[model samples]
Target: MRTAKFWMGTLLAGALALGYGCGSDANKDPTPQDVPQQQVPDAGADAGVVLTLTDAQIARVLQVANEGEVMLGQYAAPLATDQAVIDFNNQMVTEHTAVKQRLDALLAAEGITPEDSPLSLQLQAEVQQLMDVLQGPNAPAAGAALDLALLSAQLNAHARTAFIGDSLLTPQATNTALQQELASERQAVQTHINEASDLQSVIVLPPVEP
Candidate 1:
């Protein structure tokens, strides 16, 4: 049961990180830009793999990518004591921020404004719950326990985000630019997952009291 709880906590923390940090006004109207329209190439030709995704799915992808950055980006400051974790956190923030920008540009090009999905809301709730626990009195101390919590959460979050990028967004996205961005983001997320796992392996948690 403890193991299950720990895994669940990490999963929720990840979902929260992905869903949080999205601005409340993200769904607001986008200012018109004079961006040139790149024609979506034929799926069979130059396009490697093309999946037809609805505008809503594209927007959800944008939301997740954008919010995920915000969540991970905020970690460096709080976990700054550990140089390794800080370095990893900073890298994630940079990579995710770039991906978010790319997703925003893609949305603008497609003239599809982003909106929050039901899934996003659910993720946000889960994250909020995790945050509550972290802030509670019984929360882990500011060393291995805290590091493990953050790392574990980020690991699960990256894994989930990578799955979405690979399985859901990449396959269904028709835009060449979006596809390229997803491919790169997917690779980056995988890298983070591996790094987080490696870090987690070395963290020696304090023994639990009976």
Candidate 2:
């Protein structure tokens, strides 16, 4: 449950920050952008992969990506003591949540209920295992490490997701919210990766100039 708090707290803090920072727009379009049109996936990748995803497929993808991104943001939020890292984490959470909202609107237009991804469901299971570990003696450092890794993966995962969403949903005419969200996410992840890289350095002394 404490682990759960880690995830939820990140989301809550991020939303609060977003709401206070710029104020989310429920009605405004994400903004106009030049996203490439959707393309069909590789035919050789999988036998059962559908070429043209239904509206349902789109919705499911959005739902999982949003929730996962939030969880990822939450996981990353407290991992860094640096201000940049914290800001980046907050940016990721805010953007993804906005994406989730946009996707939700699209889904409701079709009267759909989004389902969690099998991949995310598996992650949740792993989270459960992590929670078990956190409850025991491995709670402190192990838990902290777990959040770091998860958020790192989230940044990468979100990149792929952005590509996939652009391809599948064809967000050519995004509103101000979606556009800003995309920009924020792209920037946040890049910043987060840099910060994480700095933190992970071995701290070797500089080589003497020959």
Candidate 3:
């Protein structure tokens, strides 16, 4: 069983190496390949989708999510020049780190060891795909391009985070404290989505003349 800390460390290190350790490609907009996302049922749909995830899996999902957000912020902060981007990155790092620590504490207190599930592994793969886009040949150059890349990724990530939390983790969590925490975190993810959208609007270049 890979520990959460080990998973976090491995992801962070690999993202750092991919985004910064390798020389960046300039004047190129990152176009990340489409990655598979969690499929949540629409409102008013039949309650047909059954999730068999355990509380331990829910814990892993929370841990993986917070860690991924932290890595995303940390990887992009140094490359960002815009003050708004910088501030957003800082906020992500701070908030996600705090939430992750709290989650760890809660799990420890409850003697719950996070066990990775298919959802958690898929989330990890999605993060890796995002990193590949940011670091690959078409990786954005520093400045507005980089800001756009980071903000776009953030928006999508937070949206997915909310979906998984609301549709899967929160519902599956049996612990009252864990459910409450997931609710709070989902709210935070929504805020992050709004912030990222605003930032993307600010940084995205206008359409080029034909």
- Best candidate, TM-score-wise? 3
Candidate 1 lDDT by residue in tens digits, 116-204: 55445444554454455555565555765666566655654665566456545666677676667677766776666667666655554
What tens-digit string does per-residue lDDT give for candidate 3 at 39-140? 322323323434467788889999999999999899878878889898998899999999999999999998889988766886887777777677776666
For candidate 2, write residues 1-210 as lDDT tens digits: 011111322222332232222212311221111011112223343444323433444456556656766765676577645454566567768876876777577556656655544323433443344334333453334333443333334434444454444433345323444445445544544454444334322111223679
From the highest TM-score down, the ranking of the candidates is 3, 1, 2
Q: Which pairs clash in the backbone of model 3?
A: none
The lDDT per prediction is: 0.53, 0.43, 0.68
Residue 72: error of model 1 in Å?
3.5
Backbone clashes, each candidate: 1, 8, 0
Off by over 4 Å in 3: 1-50, 205-210
Model 1 poorest 10 in a row by lDDT:
29-38
lDDT of candidate 3 at residue 136, scale 0 to 100? 72
For model 2, the stretches where C-alpha displacement exceeds 4 angstroms are: 1-52, 115-151, 166-210
Give the TM-score (vs. native) of candidate 3: 0.73
* Total clashing pairs in model 1: 1
